[model samples]
Target: MKIMVGLGNPGKQYEHTRHNVGFDVIEELSRRFNIPLDQSKLKGLYGIGFYKGEKVLLLKPLTYMNLSGESIRAVMDYYDIGLEDLLVIYDDLDLPVGKIRLRQKGSAGGHNGIKSTVAHLGTQAFNRIRIGIDRPQNGMSVPDYVLGKFHKEEQLQIQDVVQKSADACEACLERPFIQVMNDFNQ
Candidate 1:
């Protein structure tokens, strides 16, 4: 089984913020694959789906961003899956918006969610799909930009990027992490 965990805060208020792109990707996959992530347990709302004949666990952690690892560790242990079988998705501010970087293993790059996950998992090695949320121009603060919603034009661009990220995730289930990193990282 493959575990795909998306990191973000839960609840209505954080719904459309740039930080919630991870949740958005999971939602997109849920809607597209008929996964019906109606169950809530292990500190998350998730479901199982078959992608390329592989059983994949689609997770949106409800423990919020900083404590996301608790949810991830719980699910992974329950399924007896190794860290290598895990795929994480989250927003990134370092890259330009509308781009994604697939990494087989790497540091968190100051992402609290990823940092927490790595700490709990006890390793820096894990597959990740980073959806670029873009750094603010003109010296705008990082927190303000991440917590904010996208502009009208950005909304369309981000939606398209999210869909493409989902496709890349699907491809990961059918291919090796090295292959995915080489093909999807940019």
Candidate 2:
């Protein structure tokens, strides 16, 4: 089985923020695959379904962003999923908006959610799909920037990225992580 986790704070206020892009991707995936996120457990909302004939568990961490690892660890333990079967999706300020980068394993690169995940998982070896939200403007704090909503133009682009990210997740279910990275990391 494979588990794809989308990290973000849980609340209506954060629904449209840049930091919630991960959640957006998960919602897109759910919509595309007909997976219903109807269960709340492990401090998250999750649904199990088939994607490309493989069992896929779609998870949205409800423990918020920084403590995402807690919910992820719980899900991993409960399902007995290994590192290789786990894929995390989140927003990245380092990449340009509407772009995505996939990595088989790497450091968190200063993402708090990734930091918590690495700490709980005890390794940096896991699949990740990073949706770029672009860096904050000069003089804007990182927190404020991440928590801010996108402009109308940016939102249009983000909608495209969300769909592409969902396609990437589907590719991961059918192909190896490395191949998925090579195919989607453009």
| lDDT on C-alpha atoms for all candidate structures | 0.89, 0.92
Error of 1 at 27 (Å): 0.8
Where model 2 places Cα greater than 4 Å from the true spot, the runs are none
Q: How many backbone clashes does candidate 1 have?
A: 0
Tens-digit per-residue lDDT, 42-72, candidate 2: 8999999987688989999998899999999
lDDT by residue for model 1 over 1-186, one digit each (tens)? 888888999999899799999999999888877788987999989999786688888999999899999999998988788888998999999978899998877898999999999999999888899998889888889888888898888998899999989988888877788887888764
Which pairs of residues clash in candidate 1, taking residues 3 or more apart in a chain or in different chains?
A: none
Q: Number of clashing pairs, model 2? A: 0
Which structure among the candidates has the greatest lDDT?
2
Error of 2 at 163 (Å): 0.8
- Worst 10 contiguous positions by lDDT, candidate 1: 177-186
What TM-score do all the candidates reach, one by one? Answer: 0.95, 0.97
lDDT of 2: 0.92
